[model samples]
Target: MKSNPSTDPPAEFLARMSALLPAAEFAAFLAAFDRPARVGLRVNTLKISVPDFISIAPFSLAPLGDWEPAGFLVTDDSRPGRHPYHDAGLYYLQEPSAMVAAALLAAAPGERVLDLAAAPGGKATHLLSRMAGPLPDAPLSALRRGLSSGGLLVANDVHGGRARLLADNLARWGAVNALVTQAEPAHLAASFGPVFDRVLIDAPCSGEGMLRRGEPVEWSAAIVAACARRQRGILAHAPQLARPGGRLLYSTCTFAPEENEAVIAAFLAGAPDFTVIEPARHAAFERGRPDWSAAPPAIADQLARAVRLWPHRFPGEGHFMALLGRDGEPGDEATRVAPFRRVPPSGEQWRLWRDFAEASLTVALPEERIHAHNDRLYLLPAAAVAVERLRIVRYGLLLGEMRPGRFQPAPDLALALRAGDATAALDLWPDDPQLAAYMSGAELLQAGADGWVLVAVAGFGLGWAKRAAGRLKNHYPRGWRRG
Candidate 1:
């Protein structure tokens, strides 16, 4: 597929839009497709504040809105993805409109949060950034020193490949109290019950929104219908995962009402506990079209609370979002779900990890939350539950593994730690020649005392290197090496 896409949209798609929109409005909507899409760089508050990032950013950036303090639009072609700051877990280059849903979910710090269908980790990263800290003296634990300290995020993608990718992105975000799992939505609902305080389902849909972005997706009316069916099936598991009085946000990056309001209407028909909550109005946000969904007057009236962002109406690609609020608060004894059965860190792997942390890290992890999954040792969030039957791609933070008598750290640990959190580190400027060499899997010649060294770009942790024989041998993952 060509990285640069053609400006013209599919003929059938244009025809559908003409029928859906008013004549004058349709003309403007069509014109939007011919224009460029707005790219977004959501700041990682877990790593740096928006003001701080702006002060140091090399790329041109403009704030999207005050509604989202961390959200910004990239104003120029300053390929940030290749920058050293990116490797430092600074920001995520997400689509502008796509950034809205997570903010709408308003996942506060110290809440038990879940990002269903989380992949490429965009929304999951946002939720975790806001979720870093204690889920209180409860099940969730996003523990850190000062940044809201306790809460936990459970991000799941059913596909194994996408789940792995999700794990990588969240790790790079320095998420400590999050779990990345590969499982069906129903399986998660069954395993955890309604334990989460906030649940976000960014459903897969027909790529009508990507028409302007030039995403290589073949769209058709049949596909829209298929997507709507799948969306409804997925939403069936939503209510079961959300705690009473908790919030659930359903979103899709599509212009189709079938996948937006219609799917929401269908979900409401089956689940009576949820009520659509109107979000705080923004000038760019338009109410959903009830008639478009062919829903009844009463149901349609509630669906009107849903919001739509058109490329023509908003400074972004198209998107649809609906926030549903579950009815009561969390005090039902029957609804309580079991937490991840704690297997206190033991055996050779546990001993090796303890040795490494004692020598390397300035802080100690919670022993009760440490889970030894097979040969690897994972530091799970406090809210994590046992999933012996489920397929887990990444279980919390993989501190490292034990090989015979020695412990080797994972790159995930480096990213999750601060430069100051480690006993020793190699801090370098973004433009340092050694930065390129480290990324290229080249060893750095350094004369220093070191066991496990945290490599930092500027002041943030990037990856790792080990100092031995008067030199820092590169321990950067081979797959991430770039020339």
Candidate 2:
């Protein structure tokens, strides 16, 4: 058979895959590689509803079935990431298959959750949105209360740069209760032993799924073996982070059985305290092939409960998922951190922020929640974990920094604020020329009083501006400025 020239999966790889999948199914899988890759975006319920987003969305979208309620398949050629809605944190552009892990983790409204390998924060943000419930309608105070009292989320990445990226994404998602940490898996496991109610490990894997992006996949045996070994090490440390009876979700974008079924089989054998849970059934989701697993019949039977999303069967690249439950009574909760002493802002710092908030914000943020570190001010969630040992990128929502006597709101604070939350807002239409100018960091004339102003598009806050002498000085971060 002539392999697809565009998306070259190694011929040897294809031959190996052929033995794993049935003859007809294997042919369909190859044909799927020739078709254009499908694109999807998941609505950020922390900011807007799926229905509300659909009403205002410029692109045409199709529902993504019952499995992913907030997910939509974009049929239009609109670049969603370039839109103002994206700047406002309304949605996330993610692959359809990548959305499954968090949904299957099924985190509840008040549970401590951890994304052990979180970076670039797709699953971490999704987990937070699920835990916080729907947004806009859910009052900010209630959201804060739920996050602090119910539980908090900790997103960790091994790489420092990616950990910063994860913090940025969570900040945009308005996850005030989230902690972004950079640490080795074993060290984190030691510090937070059996503390999380739910843990997700989207382990690093060989890029077999990269074929969907028209990227050539190197499926050599050596690469597959290396990925499997790394995945096993990650899995070894991940379960220790989940409390007794808590759930652990393992996922990867590769189709290799060594990285998928075999890893799970080995983990199950070593950790008899954990048992496999059947994946949520979906028409597009197929069960793991026990025949592909080299484990004994009993272990393979348990592995069959794992789910596989094949490109041929679904509108996404291939993925593998296994859900496991730690065995024990469900009451093994971790010790909650006592409330930390919040250092009040200095007299001048307090005056500047107070005057700004009173003038520009309609909502009253609690004084107790505000914490001052150096010249920067942070709005902490209801609770915070100890960060003495971890490389913490962001502790909570950064309200902004104080410059001399002046107070400046951060871009993160701007995205986190709702239109209604701000008293002095410059609301712009999606197509309004001023919106582009604002995003581009161009100064503009304003009729409002001289002070800080919220720049908004379609009632969603985009960033900040300072009005003086009838001119609005753009306060949009230079790093985020559009060319």
Candidate 3:
């Protein structure tokens, strides 16, 4: 006799899920676990339009419908992640369900935004692009101009390593108005103090929704409970960083009610200033089950406004989201930019950078935005405030570093620059051997001026090159070199 498929999951988890979902729906959900996982990507609107990407894209893509305008379901074996377009920050490979939270946040241009647990930068990048409006049609000279003139995005992660990765992705995506930080929630709450127009907590969860990814997780009641407790703690500090009348978006990839509805219910009880708002719903999205929470009917009914994405009903993995609006008038607190202390370069130091910028850059970088910390130089956003206490990995756009005498451009500066921003550049096609050589950290035979040159692929900046004698010396970061 064949074994029962229902028993594939731990009996306790199955029982809990059965109690939460309708009998037929629970069975369908279980069957969905056996099906192949869906592959999806969100077009980086900062670089290419949805229609333009579709026209030039090598793979076949089916629209993910109105739920997400930029999201698409991959229908072919083409590895877009490995493509040169990815290096150019043309798109981001993300789970279809995970894309819902940022869209629900509905971040408008010029709003102060924060991705509390942002790492690997899927949602953070999405938020950045949304704030910047449509960059595909914008001129190259206007590329640095993002959504709001004073709007800023602070992407934070607790882990240092992930924080670095977050900075890398945002840099590639050309988020000029972003700041990357690694800090605890309590610390952020203390420093920011209810200042953000929108705060997103894609909270840490028990990975219940990612089972189809082929990773084995030892699911137990204790693990689920622990995750719920941690999520509540994170949510507790979220409101402190959100301005009154601003919005806070809470999301998780777990199916456990403890981590989803229960946490939200508890938060609603404690934070009277914040109220749950109904997210834009679709037929594919199910309302949060009030009965599943331990709260009273009145409170539980409020939780119903939250949205849930089930793998069985939708072509994506499980996800839960609740958008909460803080009550009050829009105050100056929401618009106050951080007061970042400037570290101006000395006369000698300024000369080196000025010479390089004059020679290589077509656009002039404002002196106020440029700062020098020791040997490294950075270009902060115009609205950047002081973050003296936070563990910031990257304060702003890293312009480059000062060596013994000459100024060396950072890879981040190259990636952040538009095609028209660089006066001297070596443009190569994706298939060009020289492109491979530059990416692999090999010397390029291309001759140019005896100074810095932007190495570009398909009009998108890849990295930097220093030309001297007769050839271009590859300046791509060794850590990012393609093997």
TM-score against native, each model = 0.94, 0.94, 0.95
lDDT of 2: 0.82
Candidate 1 residue runs with Cα over 4 Å from true position: 1-7, 133-148, 333-335
Model 2 per-residue lDDT tens digits across residues 280-396: 798888898778878987788888899999888888889999999998755524655445456789889999899878888876777877889888888776656555467777767
Whole-model lDDT per candidate: 0.82, 0.82, 0.84
* Per-residue accuracy of model 1 over 150-231 as CA lDDT, tens digit each: 6678899999899999999988887877888888998998777787889999999997888887667888999999999999
Among these predictions, the greatest TM-score belongs to 3
Compare the candidates by lDDT and give the number of the best one.
3
What's the TM for model 2? 0.94
**Clashing residue pairs in candidate 2, if any?**
none
* lDDT of model number 1: 0.82
Candidate 2 lDDT at 231 equals: 91
TM-score of candidate 3 on Cα atoms, chains taken together = 0.95
Model 2, residue 183: distance off in Å is 1.1
